[model samples]
Target: MDNNMLILSEGMHTSIQDLGRKGYRAFGVPISGAMDKYSAILANKLLNNDEKLPVMEMTLIGPKILFEDNSLIVLTGADMAPHINGEAIQMNFVYKVTTSDVLSFGNLKTGARTYLGVKGGFLTEEKLNSFSYYEGVTSKEKVQKGDRLKIASIEAGLNPSSSKIKVKSAHFKEKKLEVTKGPEFNRLTKKHRELLFSKEFKIDAHNNRMGYQLKNKFPPIKNGEIITSTTIPGTIQLTPSGKLIIMMRDCPTTGGYPRILQLTDIAINQLAQKKENDSFKFDLESSFDFLGRLVNRFKD
Candidate 1:
């Protein structure tokens, strides 16, 4: 029998994603991929799969899948209570499943998104050289029930190797996000600059893949118009009305808001795991000073 993952039940928002497309954002393409890349890499690492392999990213809830053949699988990121054949499975570990075995998830324990990776990865066609699903780039933007997904062909008799890794608790813990001054950082008044660092911002209900609306009142910036500027994930823009919007993985290539702060890559990963209503402050860091700290943090 051909190896396939049949989607019996689709969750709130489940879609296939990889590292994301690059070199095309200049043409107005958003880089859509796994929101929590660290977790996605962990899932793929457990199965010894390629780092860029496309995996199913589940938001809030997860899906029920039926395996048509034996394969290795791993679940990471949010604890969604994944199970097989009614038996619970632990996260950050590799498991083997056979035909007729069913995978499912229950209530979310923490975090926002979950990633599921198979041994050979999901065999989905790539758009713009990336397996990520963007609305206009891919034929299917999100996975739905009754869809049968192909699994990359693997040789018979190959079994999954047992492997596990423990993730740090701080990755999901709500804490201060580190950010550096942006292009227009100096344009803000001293009082507004102080407020940006001192105030605790809550993620509004309008948060999504595009951007996060931070619900906090800060001193309004004087109206100033500039040429549209290039932006990527982690760019924090402040509007004239004193609203702060943090760009995410699917943010547009260019924006006109005053770019006031830019989150670090680590901060971006931290924000990706956060859901609505979560509050966090900013840890403003200087690029020169943050470099040594970032290097040492990753070195350990």
Candidate 2:
């Protein structure tokens, strides 16, 4: 396995990520991983790699790289116009890259992030048992132009093989995010609760891996102050100033704001791919339907 990729240019923010660090949140470690887990897993599935294998996660722009050795690769998530040696390549399809072949991207067609999965996952040092990158947690938080990613070495001659899988294009077009009542959902006034589900919320310009700030001001909950309790991705916090903050993959482990709503796993995945300025409505789901949504998310 002499496969390695030389980064000719780092696009926007490219990093190596797997599922995430699972057990370190008790120590205040954030679970940082691919923003679009569905697409990341799809890339791995096409390569026949482990579902949790680390892949290159890129936001908006993508990196320019030169393959040092022949290898199989797949791209998923956002339709970043990927090209090999100046030729355009399609998403969700496994392709073979010859030595010295350069990979680059053009305009982002849809979604916010993209995932690149190599046949053998990138060989990178891990922290807290996860390849997911986070500042202070990983030696290198983001991919750099001069970085050389270590990959599995391959023999000079091997039979070529690849696969293509189609996914519902509707997933990328969905604008309604289903959410369940949060711990503090009842603390809001009845009218405010009604407004929450009725009002349209646009993603603010401050959106990042940490979280998203909703453009609309949420009605503050009575006695909104609370001890910094355990928090996770999808926890919607309503601040005293009537602001809504939706936790994301790199969000802090705890928060003091009132958690007014909790996005279902499906909603989190959907919101993860959403970019700034994108608007969405919260579709409140019943408890019974929430469980069914959870089951359906994994089924896909």
Candidate 3:
């Protein structure tokens, strides 16, 4: 029998995602992948799969899946109260499931997304060198009920020891996101700059894969719009009406709003776990220090 999992219910929003496409942003393609990359990687690592292997990313809620063959799996990010065959399972721990075993989830304990990783990863369709599903870029934007997702077959005789690693819960609970000054950071008035750091901004309901709109507003910049500057995930823009928008995974390649600050990669991952109405403060870091840390990370 083929190794596949039948999706009985597509809970909220679920999609197959990897590390995301590379070098396609030049063609106006947005990098759409798992919102919580750190958690996704952890899920794959627990199963001894490639860090970039595609996994099931579940948002808010999770799906109900029925296994058709024996497989190894792990769940990470957000305690959605996962259960297999009516038995609750622990997050971040590897488990083996046989055919006919059912997997499901309950209420969200914390965080906004959950990642499920198979032993050899899900065999989803790939485009532009990624399994990430994006509208107009992939055949399917998200998984739906009655879908049969193909998975790599696992060896029946293989028996791997269970993982003992424990990820810190701080990533999901962190409220201060680290950021660096953007190109137009110097154009802001001293009062505006102070407000940016001091004020606790609430995430507006206009939050999604594209970007997040903050509820707090600042004084409109002298020149609100830029010359259609390049933008990537983590670019925070300020609009003419004092609106703040933080670009996310699926944001456009270029934007006209004034770029006020750029979030670090760590901050981007941290912010991904946040949901609507969540409040957070900015922890600005000097450009020189941020650069030094980046260099050290690469050197290590």
Candidate 4:
């Protein structure tokens, strides 16, 4: 079927997200979606969907999906042990979801979120011109178990069988995020500036789509400025305890804190998928380099 959709089992942490709805930010709206957009868009494309098709953005655990009708679907981003009717299914590959069949996501295998997208995509209520879900800004809310999804109508109806799946590329090889010092980057001494990237911080459990709080073994802020003003998604805010926070997709539009460094957009998406204490090195790649690398990462 084209868009006839049914949620057989909504995973514990699932949200409807696309590229994101813009123009709501002035009212404190956030552009929320899969942290790993590279993979997110890849899934949509596999379904022959537009780059902005609404996809199921699942966390470390994926939800079970029951199809009301037959459809071609794809899963991308982090590895959430996926299985269909108890049989293991692969990630980053397109598959067919049949009516009366069950699609279940078990646990987080690698990254934090897994994205599920169907051919064309399921149509949900829109807010500010986007089907991407936010804090219930529209009638639709974050995806939950047993939710019924209405397709765009045209995207549904077509029947499909098996999938000609493609391979996925390495994450680290392509993307680079351009980081600029935060608003309060000046607050930290020169030494702090140097150590911001030089120092290694461990991601803590107290992290969410809002931001990632990193454990600082060596806090560099001494005569740090007073904390005030909002922070961006990639902002690395330093707390009084010297902990550093890297904001993410659902991060508040504003915050009053001493943000010393900002992870570039590309890295924000990449690192967002990282598990707790998953160590990675940072290279101060420029915005130009980031885009160039990402484009080259994929084989044409």
Question: Which candidate ranks first by TM-score, i.e. highest?
Answer: 3
| Candidate 3 residue runs with Cα over 4 Å from true position | none
Best-to-worst lDDT order: 3, 1, 2, 4
TM-score to native of every candidate shown: 0.95, 0.95, 0.97, 0.83
What lDDT is obtained when candidate 1 is compared to the true structure? 0.88
Positional deviation of residue 83's Cα in model 1 after best superposition, in angstroms: 0.7
Candidate 2 TM-score to native:
0.95
Better of 2 and 3 by lDDT: 3
Whole-structure CA lDDT of model 4: 0.71
* Residue 107 Cα positional deviation in candidate 3, in Å, after optimal superposition: 0.4
lDDT of 4 by residue, 53-121 (tens): 888888776676767776777788877788888999887777766667778877666667778887878
Instruction: Please state every model's RMSD to the true fold in angstroms.
Output: 2.2, 2.0, 1.2, 4.0
Clashing pairs in 2: 1-152, 1-153, 1-154, 2-153
- Please list the residue runs of candidate 1 whose C-alpha ends up more than 4 Å from where it truly belongs after superposition: 293-300
Rank the models by TM-score, top first.
3, 2, 1, 4
Weakest 10 consecutive residues, lDDT, candidate 3? Answer: 156-165
